[model samples]
Target: MTDRSAAGTTFDDFVAARSTALWRSAFLLTGDRHKAEDLLQVALVKTWRRWDRLTGGVEPAEAYVRRALVTTYTDWWRRRWRGEVPTGELPERPTTGRDGPGAVDVRRDVLTALAGLSRGQRAVLVLRYFDDLTEQQTADVLGVSRGTVKSQASRALAALRSSPALTDHDHPATEEEPS
Candidate 1:
């Protein structure tokens, strides 16, 4: 048999092998399918750019892609034209022409709670918990010190715990506002 791929792998084959896992990571990072697709596209572009540099194997390629995804997500939030997608578990609205006030309230609360976080804090939490990055990896991904990552993560969790969205489980209901 003759060898065809110089690196012994085709780009299309690589995409086929990794797209599912990559899509899952992207979803966790962006909290929305649309944003996830955008992130994945950016990651793929970066992967293509460095394909030769990633000749070590899939492990290196995967790491490169992950790093790209995380960095792209961080930059996206920092953009003036970008907005946070809703990060809650519910349908947007009811089909029966109902106000679905409770659903709307819940969604708003969740969105507000997440918004309470600094961009760095949110990225830290998502990278650490959602993406399951080690503290060191998260720090590297965010281009910050590990100490900064830990502090931001602590503050982010504390804010989530204190958010009125959480209080809804026991306290009186109230209208939510953006953070």
Candidate 2:
């Protein structure tokens, strides 16, 4: 259905073009594929409800949706619900023949480290690094000061570096300066 809005873009068209990227951001924010899908759906529905209000069209709508996604994730984290509990046994990861075991290991390690971060810290990292948003933009999205964004990102990176999952083995050694 070609349901075009006043902004000259159909919701379907917007979703078709942007859903994958949105989903990736959601996954990184939530640290689960299933939760990512749920979060994206919720954000998209919220965006669609006010799609016409986004006068700048798709770009503005995307920004709005991204902010909604982050806000929703933060809300979810705050709600201390007894959600799904993990068992002692780890689940098997599906591997693509293209990426080697090392790649998978690094990816897993990074995700684990990210999951350990506080919601605000994780949101800052995802928006700043993954979404490639400027510090000002990230602060605007999170409704915090630019300094807060910088501090959060710094703390997040420091935590990641010190995480056992992403230790010296996972990183390349830098050359030492001669004293």
Q: Largest TM-score belongs to which candidate?
A: 2
- State the lDDT of candidate 1 residue by residue for 1-179, as single tens digits: 12222166766677888887888767655555687898999888878876766776676677778778878877877783265444444345442345354645654565567666776777787778767789998888777899999999878877887776668654323445347
Off by over 4 Å in 1: 1-9, 80-112, 167-179
Candidate 1: residue pairs that collide: none
At residue 143, give the lDDT of candidate 2: 98
- lDDT values, one for every candidate: 0.70, 0.81
TM per prediction: 0.67, 0.85
lDDT, candidate 1, at 128? 86
The C-alpha RMSD of each candidate to the native structure, in angstroms, is 7.6, 3.6
Model 1 clash number: 0
